[model samples]
Target: MTIDEQTVDKIAHLARLELGAQEKQDMIADMNKILGFMDKLNEVDTTGVEPLIYMTDEPNTLREDVIKQEITTAEALSNAPDHDGSHFLVAKVIK
Candidate 1:
């Protein structure tokens, strides 16, 4: 499709692009060239081409989730400078 100068100016306005009269004309020509290339690509034959999902053979590599042994309260609190029974105490996080 042929893109007119008015259409190009409208597009520039929508995209927030600042262009002079000559630049607008140039941009319209470039946009039409791109559209022409796309139209030419439409004539090519692609009867049975497989869609690419991934580049590598290994698509997914997820480790199995498992629960293991944990640490004791005293062991965890040993290094803490402040604690109260089962909770770790510190300066106020917010006013």
Candidate 2:
């Protein structure tokens, strides 16, 4: 699979990118080179290789989540500029 000028144009349009003529040409060349390298990688022998999930084989240790402190709703609303006893009030932003 090779990238052409038309393919690069379509890709640019999909990505909402505005490329100059030279940039477009460069993209085509770069994309074709990437595909060529991928094709070469596909020719390598890997019949008995295991897929790598991580770089090392160490178990991840996670600590339990515990609430250290708690506060009342009134305490939380104390510093608000505007509130309605239970909820905060703000200017209407959407029509």
TM-score of each model, in listed order: 0.54, 0.66
Query: What are the lDDT figures for the candidates, one per model?
Result: 0.89, 0.92
Poorest stretch of ten by lDDT in candidate 1: 43-52
Q: Candidate 1: which stretches are off by over 4 Å?
A: 53-95
Residue 9 of model 2 has an lDDT of: 87
- Tens-digit lDDT string for candidate 1 (1-95): 88998888889889999999889889988999999999999888877977778988886989998887588898899889999978899999799
Model 2 earns a TM-score of: 0.66
Runs off by more than 4 Å, candidate 2: 66-95
- The local distance difference test score of model 1 is 0.89
